[model samples]
Target: MQTTSHILMIRPVQFGFNAQTAVNNAFQQVNNETGVQEKAQQEFDRFVALLRGHGVDVTVIDDTPQPHTPDSIFPNNWISFHHDGSVILYPMFAENRRLERKPHIIGKIAEQFRIGRTTDLSDFEAKNLYLEGTGSMVLDRTHKVAYACLSPRTHPEVLKAFADATGYETVEFHAADAQGVAIYHTNVLMCIGDDYAVICLDAIPSKEERKYVEEKLKGSRKTVIAITLDQMNHFAGNMLQVQSLRGRKLLVMSTQAFSSLTPGQITELSSFNPIVHAPLDVIEKNGGGSARCMMAEIHLPGKG
Candidate 1:
């Protein structure tokens, strides 16, 4: 199981201009009040400190100034680490995002974990197929199941390749955003942890598909914490569960997600795990992603 402590993050150098995400990420901006670079650093520092305070061992890498990857803050979309020691590099739909996959980043991680193999699925982009890593799919690592919502941004071929390489079963569905447009990434609508799942069922309008997902979660012994469309708009469904240093569990989300929750939802969730949140107004407004996007959990076995 992956915890917040065992995660990786990249500090953004050019945090405001992501042409790749701009195609679907209308939320990003360059604020005059807060310089892009300064704001990113401050956000990174606070995020890291919060993770560490909860006993998460965070490995932070500075983004290189030469090759600017504006959406570098959302590394989970580019790469993923598995318990089997295999690292999968995804095919991002965005040209700029494709550059976010750096071999050096993998090399740095190799110092602490054994990398049995590296699968490069980025070549599939030539065929117009993409699977933006964890952003395209929320994985139930313990069960080896990947829940994917198909859209222009998430191709089935790439999802199958990941499943074949990782030995995971695929649960595919179609989801639309508030405007009835296809939701760009799967991570924004759901997160699966050891004992629970937070999801926006309204996003999956199909009655059958929603029932299937709900049944699957129940079958897996996961307590379902459903969020409303309004809460989902506030990014409430984008929460992740991780273990703290003391082995206690924490359900991590942004202040926006926390504030969007109802008193009943918060009380129900608190029964499973304590909730932890950090302010991500600037990051969310400009990056179009929140806490879950900022982290790439490391589930690889230790080298030693």
Candidate 2:
């Protein structure tokens, strides 16, 4: 299955503007640091409640205050859980962000799911090369492909290593924004669903690369729903499709992202799954990530 009902979320302890990520992440903005963590917590709780109300299984873990990790809320960047009961940790670009990975969190998850062998790719950080987990590479698990865009946070060597470790084919491409600046994460410009793909084709300037991506998606039986660069800025491409407890398909995104979608695009997406959105203005402004980034889908099997 491409989507999972179980998800892992990190409750913020000291959420604020991250200076380290702001270098490449243009979506981030600095708000008043005072009491921002409180506001972000409120938003996080409400978002999780909304997901739970929709019958999505969410595991909320409170973050530690000792590390002062501002972007700890986005756990998908540090670690990913797979259906094979394997846990893979990726190297983060920022020094402080690397501190987000804690063994205690994985141990907490192990209580519910049976975790197999663990793979640590954080050694690449010593070489100044990094690949921020799902943020840098969007996986099409069903097809065993990892779609990645090259950036400072996503190096080709690290991506190849990830592919080698996971047995996934690497579909590498370069993506840029309206101003021709490289996008920091592939998830910011594209998302892979079971039967469809939401992507900003304009971001891929190379016609051959764009064709390669489109052909691959078509080969995998996915309808391509292209969004413009403006819509991408609004985070329209940053969406996740998951199954509810009742087996209904739901596409999740931020309210801001949903609002930016065109009527035609909405209809196209609704043809595949219903839309579920929550207001994430505060989190998106401070963290540079949306609904998809907040929840790390847990594909690990439950303990028997």
Candidate 3:
């Protein structure tokens, strides 16, 4: 139940570097290449094709050019669709990212998915508190556990708000790089699949917190595949396990991530599900997010 066959993605029209996000996201490398947008579009198309080839149901929405939202392609940061027909919207850290939460995108999704109501948490923006949807927390949906790494973008009160609203338990810890700078988003450090969790325990500075997270993962009956800080930086931890329409479970990551994994690590993961990946160099270089961040799993009931 943690994985979904259906996913939502936004096709970027102006995909490029975002200065607003670069202030915090260490993974984002600023590039001034002439054909950055063109290359990103190509990568986006190929990633979508890869997903569809695996029998994954993907709803692609074209981003509007007028808004000039550079980070629109990473829609998982702004909105998330739930199985109970509740579409949850979160407050974004970057100002321009707020524009990515378009009413029309939700309308477009409603054509084939049933969205009964929406819970807007964007009001927290006025208070200067932000929670960038799944980027702030990698959810263990089946257990109703929200694992989060507290950062400038993720606030305690906002996490509390979400927990109160959705009846989910929040498991929070501070995550940082070797330089001690915050990692920006939780998904970059860990990914929670249906039966396993790939995490970088070294990222959690507090020893107590590291042990606590490990206990939680094990207590939930999940097989733990720990990745190093180096592997995590290469996007190895940013994976998602999704069931295909034909009833096969598949683990999806970027080619960069898949290549970063060791043979043993690959073998351990392959035991649970077959792996799927695609080239996303341009998108990851400019966006500071990889495969998992681009996918917003659509758990809504199908329209009858």
* Whole-model lDDT, model 3: 0.92
RMSD of each: 1.7, 1.0, 0.7
Q: How big is the RMSD of model 1?
A: 1.7
The TM-score of predicted model 3 comes to 0.99
Off by over 4 Å in 2: none
lDDT of 1 by residue, 1-304 (tens): 6454588899888887565676765345544555866876797789889988888788998888757788889999989998878989988888877888787888899998888888999899999899988989999988888999998779988888998898999999988877887888888899887888899999998999999988988888898988887887788877888786578888889999999998998998999888999988778877888899999988888877
The worst-scoring run of ten residues by lDDT in candidate 2 lies at 27-36
Q: Which residue pairs in model 1 clash with each other?
A: 5-56, 5-57, 28-286
Question: Which of 1 and 2 is the better model by lDDT?
Answer: 2
Q: Write the per-residue lDDT of candidate 3 for residues 164-214, one digit (tens) a residue.
A: 888899999999988899989999999998889999999999999999999
In model 2, the clashing pairs are none
Q: Where in model 3 is the C-alpha error above 4 Å?
A: none
- Cand. 1 Cα-lDDT: 0.85
Overall lDDT per candidate, in order of appearance? 0.85, 0.92, 0.92
lDDT of 2 by residue, 1-304 (tens): 8999999999999999999999989889866757788889998999999999999999989999988899999999999999899999999999999999987899899999999989999999999999999999999999889999999999999998888888999999999998999999999899999999999999999999999998998999999999999999999989999988788889999999999998999999999999999989889998999989998989999998
